[model samples]
Target: MKPTLAPFPATRLRRTRRTPGLRDLVRETTLTPGDFIWPVFVRDGEGIEEPVASMPGVMRRSVDKVVEAAVEAHALGIPAICLFPYTDPSKRTEDCAEAWNPNNLSNTATRAIKAAVPDIAVMTDVALDPYSDTGHDGFIENGEIVNDRTVEALVKQAMSQAEAGADIIGPSDMMDGRIGAMRTALEQGGFRNVLLLSYAAKYASAFYGPFRDAVGASGALKGDKKTYQMDPANSDEAMRLIERDLSEGADMIMVKPGMPYLDICRRAKDMFGAPTFAYQVSGEYAMLAGAAQNGWIDGDRSMLESLMAFKRAGCDGVLTYFAPAAAKLLNG
Candidate 1:
């Protein structure tokens, strides 16, 4: 129902805004630690935490350090942490077989986190770019990103994550029919409880540059990902993709590079009424944090406001690098 207000001073529209306590009473949107899915970078080592040059305040931690980070994040009430590995250049291959290796960086990190912080959900990124010589999510054959072949590889990769006890399998590959294929594999492979958070409406945007650098794909990428990732101009296409993914057994759906695509996020939620999420991609984090460091924006306030915007836009949760900071502030 639409809120009806008095025509004159009787309404006193400023009454709620005049005080923080009153404003909290009337607040329509709220953000909490549980609303975040923190994304962390994993390197291969012990006790190492290398700063990501592109994303300020973000670090690529070794497996043991990642386990420590997971414990810290869970203690802050953040329910989930997503893993992206900084694959060694030597491991990048045409077949991307490293992606499915049972003891690769991502799998090892998953197992470590699950063992250390079993209550906090461990989400794994299922993409080939981190392990691909071409640095594309899908495999290339004769100068083309072949969809079917990539989907097959993605199934194998997801199964490995499941085997490692990943709570959520995030298929960010954007390959056609990969969700259904992975879903079938998960069910048949005896891991039916694993959640499928499909990156159904991921756009191939300039916002992914920092992410590529964080995962060490920037130097290896041979061509643009425009062929597989959705075009930035299409809105209707996003709806179709989300609908199809849900039909294919996606338990949840996500819109990537979030701030720019909140409209897609809103539409996806309103259209499908599923648990919708947005990824505040690395470039978005860099721009905001970078400006804050330069004294252009109030860092803490800006971060909180930006995260609250996701809740207002109808997202059930968001994947962000600012999880711990935001959780700390909100917990206060």
Candidate 2:
């Protein structure tokens, strides 16, 4: 493609910007409900929807309330909903056995949503953070985060969610062989149709601070996730991880903490040409929300602009807490 000079005289960029209708006609990137995946936090209770302090408008809903939320999101035209849990402290364990419990917070929520709002796709986070007493995404042994053993547990966790009617199984643990292992188990267990949206390029970054708070993992976290999650300074390594996940049968790939990793999102999309998604993690939400709360930024305008950047960077969709707000604005 060669660059061409615009026709002169009437050749002003202002011509296209002359009116609201004209600007709408020339708009290049667009956002829609189909481009969103709503991530909601679930807690134990009934008729509950409690907001996270760090995330102004986001809530931790109970199972029954999660069903209601899913119905509302579907009516708003959102494509899917992802689940994260705020486990009871008593339920948390060093071995994270509750991670695969059929009646666990996430699994229970998944079953409720599938039964109540069967049309909305249900995506569950397949990591041990919320269940682990150590607040790590995987198993910890003798003060070290282990890999192979964690993958074994992750497989069981994935199967439980699948059996509970989850439409998509998202492996956010970043364990090397978990994707392939989960894929094989799902097939053997008669869930061959369940989608695997692997968190392929998740980075160990401070951006996840608010997320830790949302899931009640902040106080329990023993150490940083650097040993397992990718480093923020590497890009080539992200591509390698994305490639490996795809080869291992990942149906979709995600880059966490969306805005800071838009470059990685672009690279992953270009290199793999797969269904690439980005997580607009909680800290990013809190920063924007906090600034808006203090009159530092126009929250509404900035919110839409930030999400639009994801599409411009080649993300197929975004996992965001801003889904309902953005959907309402888009609908308007």
Candidate 3:
């Protein structure tokens, strides 16, 4: 039943907005540390916290340092951490075999984090771009990024992450049939409890430039990923991808380049009523942080407001680089 509103003169909406406590009481959305999935970049080294020049205040950390960061995040009440590898150039290859190597930078970081911070969920990226010499998420054939062959490699990568104690497998490769394939492999390998968070509506957008640089793929990429990733123009296609991935056994779905695709996020959540998430990718972070650094906007307020926008847009959580800082502010 809907409540009937009083006459305009009798109603005073601003009364609720008159004070902090009143505004809190009337607030429809809330942001918290628990609503964040922190994205951490891993590199192969010791005692290294190399800064990503494109993304201010974000670093590519070594395995031991990643473990320390995971422990800190767990203490801050952040539920999960997502791992992205900054693969060494020597390891990048046409086959991308290093993507599934048990000793790979991502896997090593996953194992270390699990050992150190058992309570925090560990999520791993299932894509080949970090390890592919061609800088494609899938194998290239006749100058095209092929789908089926790429899924095979993704399955291997997912299985390796499961073996390394990753609690969530995030397949960001955007290849068809990967969700089902990875689900089958996980079940067969007795990793039935692991969750699959599919990057179902990832777009072929210009906003991923900073991420490519952070992962050291910018120089290696042969061409754009328009063939496999979704087009930014199609909203209906995003719904279709979400449906397909959920039907194939994804426990959750994500929309990438979050702020720009908020309508898609809201639609996905409204249509599927599932655990929906979005990635505030590197470029988005850069824009906000850069603006704030130049005294254009209040940084802390903007960060919290941006995260709250995700909740208002129907996201259950957001994969963000600002997780730690936002969490600290929320805690305070």
**lDDT per residue as tens, model 3, 1-332:** 99897667587788999999999898999898999999999988899999999899999999999999999999999999999999999999999999999999998999889888899999999999999999999998888889999999999999999999999999999999999999999999999999999999999988888889999999988768899998899999999999999999999999998999999999999999999999998989999998998999999999999999999999999999999999999999
**What is the number of backbone collisions in each predicted candidate, taken in the order shown?**
0, 0, 0
How does each model score on lDDT? 0.94, 0.93, 0.94
| Model 1 agreement with the true structure over 1-332: per-residue lDDT tens digits | 99887676766688889888999999999899999999999999798999998888999999999999999999999999999999999999999999999999999999999988899999999989999998999988889999999999999999999999999999998999999999999999999999999999999999988888989999889879899899999999999999999999999999998999989998998999999999999999999999998999999999999999999999999999999999999999
The TM-scores of all predictions, comma-separated, are 0.97, 0.95, 0.97
Please state the error at residue 210 of candidate 1 in Å: 1.1
Question: Lowest lDDT 10-mer window, candidate 2?
Answer: 3-12
Worst 10 residues of 1 by lDDT: 3-12
Q: lDDT score, residue 329, model 3? A: 99
Candidate 2 per-residue lDDT over residues 1-332, each given as its tens digit: 99686677545689889999999999988999889999999999899989898889888999888988999999999989999999998989988999999999999999999998899999999999999888999987788889999999999999999999999999999988999999999999999899999999999989888888988999999769999999899999999999999999999999997999999999988988999999999989999989999999999999999999999999999999889889989999
lDDT of 2 at 329: 93
Question: Residue 203, candidate 1: how far off, in angstroms?
Answer: 0.3
